[model samples]
Target: MSEALNRNYRLCEEIGRGRFGVVYRCYSLATGDSFAVKSVDKSLIADDSVDRQCLYNEAKVMQLISPNPNVVQIYDVYEDDSHLHIVIELCNNSDLFHQIANQVFSEAEAAAVLAPLMAAIAHCHRRGVAHRDVKPDNILFDEWGRLKLADFGSAECFREGEMMSGVVGTPYYVAPEVVAGREYSEKVDVWSAGVILYIMLAGIPPFYGDTAAEIFEAVLRANLRFPSRIFHSVSPAVKDLLRRMLCKDVSRRFSAEQVLRHPWMTTT
Candidate 1:
């Protein structure tokens, strides 16, 4: 830990762990506010590795897109000879994956959950930032149960009219265009969000397989279906929205802003 960080905050117990770092509960010395600090060991990151680039980009991107209530906020950053420490607001409640594992949500309930996420994605896209990875595991909740989008290790910046090429997302949540190894735009986040909505409503992924390869095959096929047994009660309006979002044709997929304006999203 840097002296500056230690001087201003008292680092406490480990709260979480990730690929390159451990998250610790921390407290601000001056205001006594609670925060989470992700300490990344510099030694673990190779100089030219994508992980290293994303680690640094995560801070820059969070600084750019944060302050939206739905997105996790970054407060401060510190660097030492040994590690890079990023301090951010803490979302005390568990992630959306755990919540989904517990219960399936109705269309109205799922809409309620997805509204803020769509808003967050819209905000990111408008800022020229693409989350790239928008799975349930990255959706967290604060102590008040407000949904918060977390993790930016796979995020990157892009121009308004251009596309980004990289297969950078969880298999089930990745867009078909991405799986096809084609240049893609910010709408990839919408595809992932659409997958999340599907999972929340059906308690299962729209595409599934025994392995990542099979899952990617299913995603490439992009045959979205609401099995009658599971989606008999789900409204057609939401289904239409899902079709627009999860469409295999990247050009036909809904943008994050379009998703927010959809009838299913608006009415709920």
Candidate 2:
């Protein structure tokens, strides 16, 4: 493990852990700056080429999108015998998931958060990248309350006239097209974003079931119920925006650019 700790970074403490890897709070030995280091298990890399490609693709995407403030920056990627380490900006605040689990956000707070989130997604779309996974857990906040879209392990680049088919993303946030096992484009990401927005306003996902099959059925059927009590204070324009974004028809779903122009998103 000592050899895994490169000369430039000193691993401090574990900050997060998941199926892919463990994230550690590390400091740069050169500048003494703090950053989060995500170390992927080398065993996984050797076991699957697709998984390795995913990590490489994520690193490439992060490099391309790092200039945007709403996207997390990947400062470095390195590998030792046992692990692949990725160093990124350290965000002190919790993710949006924890915040929503506590309670739905107020209109102003929701707008503030969604603004940057949409902007980041728009950036990705413009670059031909589809962040197939967009959920509350993947949205992070910094110390100053600025929102950033994180986690690109499931993202892929698509060209015009091209389509991807597969079941991907969290069940509650996946688009109907993906669940139906049909080809889909970036609009699937818009659907997931809509789900995230709905949860932010209502404190829970619109669809829920005991099993994956039931959840997929609900998504395919567009069975979404808005809780008036929780979102009564939300404006009609906002609700309309959510409706458009959550549309089951991929062609009808609001694009990220269109989402930014919705009446509810206007500064006035």
Candidate 3:
């Protein structure tokens, strides 16, 4: 595979790095198009079999949701003796995390961001996919500020009676069920998205602490509150919507499709 790598992609420069791999900006010589190449070093991967299977699973999940305009496209997957390479659509702008870290978003900006994110999540649910990891870092934007959901490495397809036990996802965004090690479903993504929305409007996570345990405790026990100074113009209707979406009871939580039609999301 190493010998054939030069024939496939011409690596440019390092673009990003994550727990699993280093992403590189590359060019496809065959089509003259640019792509983000994620290379997972085999030596760095702790459990070879599980990591390889997860990589293949991620590729499969990407293919399942490829038709979605708000989901990043996975172009190719390959592996060499040294590493596994995944070629993905190159997004020009940075991720939502960077944007939020810079400052609070205006109501119009928040609405614009939420629209595509909701559509992407709805599409995933329609396809029976649950993106277990739905954090600001995974929501990327293009130059036009159009949002695209990225990183399906922690995603899973749920079937009837299927139950997931192990906790997965970023600590601040994880659902209570995940923290409890209880059987959980797709609604967990909705909760994480609600957390993201809260951050967009209030400029901070609803729950936060110095330690993971404290964060989990905050998530389970605290009520939602928005800083008036930061979100002075945000309406009660919007707050109500966030509360519903972030409901501890998964059954009572609003689905992505339902959330898209909520009044706060629809009004001018």
Candidate 4:
């Protein structure tokens, strides 16, 4: 597989790194078109471990939910004795995290960034995939400035009417139910997306803490607030949508589809 990958694409400069692998910029040997390849270290995945399962699940889930404009496209996968390589769309604008970290965001700007994501999540839910992790770091922008959702390593497949367990997600964006270790549905993704919206509009997370434990504690409380200093100019329509998306009660929380239909999302 290594030889095959080398023959098909020339893996070049390191672009990013994660828990088990490093991402490299690669080019198609036949056409010279650029792409990003994530090479996961096979040795780090213990047999029958959650990490091993997630390694394969990432590819499987991405393959299932892609071809949509907002989701990163997976091209090919190869594995050798030491590494597993996944070729995916290259997002040149870094990630949403870095893109917004130093800037102020308006409701219109935030909606532009979030609408496609919510639409993508709605598509995933319709296909039975729950993107257990939905944070700014996992959102990227392609060369055309299209928002692309990347990284399905923490994703899971579930049936409608059924719930999933086992906590999974980044602290700041994890759903309150996930923080409480309770069964959660795909609505968890909605919650995480809501957190991103909060950060975008206010330039800070709704729940905060100095550590993971403190963050989880804050999440469990599920407090939703907007400081007047920052949100005084924000509209009620957008705030209403956020409250629904970030609702502590899963039953009251907006689904991704519902989010797409919200007034703010549809407004010009």
* TM-score on alpha carbons, each prediction: 0.99, 0.93, 0.93, 0.97
Local accuracy of candidate 2 as per-residue lDDT tens digits, 1-268:
5364677899998999988789999999999999999898867665667778887788888887777899888898887777778899998688988888998777778888888899999998888889999998999988887888999998988886789876779999999888888899988878888888888888777887789888888888996667778777778877898899999877788999999998888862
* Pick by TM-score: 1 or 3, better one: 1
Q: lDDT: which candidate is best? A: 1
Clashing residue pairs for model 4: none
Model 3 misplacement above 4 A:
47-50, 227-232
What is every candidate's alpha-carbon RMSD to the true fold? Answer: 0.7, 1.8, 1.9, 1.1
Q: Clashes in each model (backbone N, CA, C under 3 Å)?
A: 0, 0, 0, 0
Candidate 2: residue 27 lDDT (0-100): 96
TM-score of 3: 0.93
Worst 10 residues of 4 by lDDT: 99-108
Q: Name the lDDT value of residue 128 in candidate 2.
A: 82
lDDT of 4 by residue, 184-227 (tens): 89999999999999999888899999999999999999889889
Q: Which stretches of candidate 1 lie over 4 Å from their true place?
A: none
Off by over 4 Å in 2: 1-5
lDDT, residue 151, model 2: 94
- Could you tell me the C-alpha RMSD of candidate 4 in Å? 1.1
- Candidate 3, residues 135-159: lDDT per residue as tens digits? 9999998666678999998898877
* Model 3: worst 10 consecutive residues (lDDT sum): 44-53
lDDT of 1 at 221: 95
